[model samples]
Target chain A: MVSALTCLFTPLLRAAELQSSLIASALWSGDSHNFKRQSHQFSLEPEAILRFDNRVKLTALMRLRSISFDGLAPQRVSDAAYSPLGKPLYMGNSSEFELREFYLELPSDNYYFTLGKQQVVWGKADGLKVLDIVNPQSYREFILEDFDDSRIPQWLANIETNVGEWDAQFLWIPEQSYHVLASEGGLYAPTSPLLLPQAPPVGVSVDVKAIDRPGRLLMDSDIGLRLSRFWKGWDLSLNYLYQYDNFALLYQDRSLTANGPHVTIQPQYRRTHVLGGSFSNAFDNWVLRGELAYFSDRYFLAEGLSDSDGITKGKEVSSVVGLDWTGLENTLISGQLFQSVALNRQSATVRDKSESTLSLLVNHTLLNDTLELRLIWLTNSNVGDGLMRLRVTYEWQDNLKTWASSDTFYGSEEGIFGQFDDNDRLIIGIELAFE
Target chain B: MKYPRLLSCWVGILSTPFFALTGLAQEPLSNAQATLPTGGQVAAHINSRDEGEAVSRKLSIVMRDKRGKTRKRETMSYRKYYAGEKRTVIFYLAPKNIRDTAFLTYDYNTPEREDDQWLYLPALRKVRRISAADRGDYFLGTDMTYEDIKLETRVSTADFNFKTVGNCDVDGHPGLHIEGTPKTQAIARELGYSKSLSCVDRQIWMVRQSQFWDIKGALLKTVTIANIDQIQGIWTQQNINVENHKTGHSTSLSFAEVDYQSPVPDTMFTTNAIKRGL
Candidate 1:
């Protein structure tokens, strides 16, 4: 079937510049108690672009993933959300294929327009996101995957123009997609106590209702606007977004019956208003960047099981400050401080009023950039928990590269990173590109 | 990104020496010329020369290691002057892994004010503001540093003290040799160079060959121009080779499809235009 599809598209693809990358990856559990092979993933990504004489461009990107596992299989076959617009095709229990992006770009001297499925990114911080909340994300591999791989593209209309010295961007996203999460029993699912609900009494039966998602095409569309300019060596931006929150809000109902206690959980989407600003400036070998965002509505689960609706709503404020130092010859040292606060904190909320995390990343290129080493450390002040990751990549040739990486989590179970301690894993992968 | 100034820096950094070439005097000096040109005078001649209004070109960089392993990158670059400052934007056109990646820079003529740069990684779909302070850092595994690319053609005479090293013959052509040392330790540190020696051809007023010494006073690298041609009445360097002795690596740059008559629009220098790709 794949061969037939390829044959059918061969002629059409010939007119466009086509490129593909094949990646094979393996994961092994690093847990002391459960030492075993986790899963193997193979992915193929192909992109094609066709351009017209008038500078109109059409681009299409597709991805296919097949996973083989012993005990770490995801319950869902596809990595994308079940959207009314479209969904990935499942070939088997562990294989799925998706048309990730298909966009047409029309450009002129002063104005540009892009229409179709695509990803829109914003903000300045890395690893810890503050205002980069345009596209929803896939948490199937947690946050270990690169943002490019994890971000879920949506159908949108993007228009950009120059307003004097400032560059302005406006977006209309109609496809309502939300975060794709790992199944509860999956290896990489969230185990943090603060994120999970309290344990119910023994013999109690729990019912989960189908998620309530926004499906109206234009009516449920998201709108965003951003204005950015470079002035006096500083890059600055102001942004606003009106959309549905990526994560669902859970509402629970509990009832006592003759048999025992019964609980029903309903997940529903909620609207949010976001206002953000970011700035970055470079001095000598150092680049400093920062982002601040205000979210009008954020929902968190209540602490106790008996709490009404088991949810609390509050206003949220998030900010991040980052610095990158490239003083050393082939090395880059980057540090970022991220903080998120619940402005209207509820006493019964599961999370604290404020959470702060610090991340340090060091990347070094060696042997004419054929070999690369990277290390990242992230710690939270409130939880005293953090994640440490190390990766090494060797490029045998310009078109091929191999890498080995390890992710480690430490601290008490209640902390975000600490909850995934047992899920620490080592991954080895190879990527080969064909142009 | 005017091609003339493109060659100016290219000529200044790669094809010419740190000081003036007596050829710009419109006359070749005999064996016994009474007066010799200083480094500042030569730099001023190179800087003041007129090239053109705007320009675009295709650039190919080939890098090879001591082991004979080679990698190549191809880019489409556009340059134009906005007021007095020069703005350049380069878009990667080859090597599928980095295709659509772009880099933009605002090079200021002011000695005290720093320049600004932005890099767009297609994978991230974001334009990043990067510091222009690391002028000594190698650019994309190439032998040339950011300084080599930015400050080459218009050699900053104030940053270095120049002296005549005497006349010599380069490739059978009579040439003037000039030596330049950094004026201050801070400037030396920023440039990662202690001293530079340049051999300028007497006929073209362009540096035919140059050598640099590292801050530690060790012989670092040598650059030689292999080809030069007059395009649109401007002497343009077509091919350049750089060898880094310390790393046992070399880079070769060749420019083609040099267009000096076309209009390189102001819109091409914006961050938004880079994202649009070429």
Candidate 2:
């Protein structure tokens, strides 16, 4: 079927007009405290875009990655993270040959149509997630990679049209996919106490059941709509999404059987309705951005030591306001303040009623932007846990770059960043691309 | 696209090898351009000249350092007029890393009205609103400032105090030399320039060369225009080069495939168009 379609479309596209790019990179990181080897990663990505005179466009991307720890033999990695319905082809324990994005765009007079396996992004926040959750993400690297690299593409249909002075986007995602988490024994697996379950009692045994993933085609699909307009000097947007939450909730059932106090744990995704709005405006050399969202029926883990279900439900509101200053030469300074609050808090809910975080970013370019320096700091106000990253990148030539970076996490064991404090590492990588 | 009053002068200035003010129907200078034109008259003449109703072209920008290492960026640029306001959009076409990135700007003729700009980054799949007030900042790692790229041969009459100095000759073309100083300290700080000297070709009424001084009163850079062409009966600047005197860095721009008669739609100047890429 694929070859037939390619043959039919081949004559319409000029060979010379097909845009292609190939990128190869090698990265190595070590434990900052122990100075021990952590992981070495190598990746290759090849992408191609074909455009016809009739305005039809096609894009395809293939990615290959291999990761090993301390130069050891490749470990057997499970494919559980991928959606069962749209899993890509895997080759050995360390290799994956996947068609990440194979989308065709059909544009009309005032409307645009895109269909296939693709990623759609919607939000105004920088380095944060709010209304940008149209597609699921991969936590394999724990939010360290650029969002473009971490967002998992899905089979979906997108339509964009101009309505009066506003732009409207409609999305229909049939692929049922959730967050891809790191393998239990993988290098980036989380060991944070807050995220882990308590140890079973001395006399009790714990049994974990397989994740109950939604498999229905139409009933379990995701849909979204976004409308944006530029009025006066401000850019404003309204967004809505009806879909399953990216993260699953743990449901526990306890019973006293012949095995004596056996606990069964099941993970299931819950549906939620999200409504949000964002606005941005620039004043002189400073730009102000803000986004707020309301989530209905979010699930949280219970704090009670002896709870039957170990789950709590509540409504939540998340908001962020940011500012960017470009007054300095070749330098950009940005700061954001974010907060999330649970409206109807439960007495036994493990999650706090209100949580706040602050992020600061500074980027400076030197030597005609050949050499770049960047610093990112994110701190949680309530927990005093935060992450800081300092990086330097140099452009050796066109489409070639070399970079070095250090990631440091601080906090107590139970805190989010504190859980990875010992995993701090320095990374050095070189990437070269050919077009 | 032709103004009858300026047609004779434009034809003679562009078709000839030299822009000499000799042997032409000696038309009297307008009130603004008296026997000795003031600096404002020269600036106004350059800004009001008719380039085209709409223009599209492929622009190549090359930057070189003291060590002779160079980087080149190529883009497709489109400019159109909406009512009296001007709108421009540029899309990057080469260098795979930055490909699919686009920038859109809406420039207002009224100096007091702030211009609106947006940059679409493909990597982030987001369109960011950017301020146009940082006109003095260098653009895309090039020696040319944002203002230089925004206003090619025109001068910002509101920001500067212009005075006619004397007669000057550049590249064998007789021209008028004008000196400009910032109108106020705030303007100087915003423009990052203390003083400027410009040479305007008398016949064509276009800036041929300009030298700038930094805010600290030190020689900053020199920009020279070349390869003037008459495309569809409109005078266009095809080649521009700027050299930073203090940093020993330079940038050169060459416009290719220039077209003024092509149909450039108003929709192409919108944010949605840029987000779609070329």
TM-score of chain B of each: 0.87, 0.86
Candidate 2 lDDT by residue in tens digits, A72-175: 22223224546765565665666656678999999988889999999898777777787789888877667788898878899999999989988999999989
Per residue, candidate 1 scores C-alpha lDDT tens digits across A180-237 of: 7777666667767577676677999889888888878888899999999988778899
TM-score of chain A of 1: 0.91
List the candidates' TM-scores in order.
0.92, 0.92
lDDT tens readout by residue for model 2, B91-201: 878788667778778888888888888888887888888777776677667776666666655677878878776667678777777778888998788777888877778
The CAPRI classification for model 1 reads as acceptable
lDDT score, candidate 1, position B49: 57
Tell me, by DockQ, which candidate is best: 1
DockQ of 2: 0.38
Worst 10 residues of 1 chain B by lDDT: B1-10
lDDT of all predictions, in order shown? Answer: 0.76, 0.77
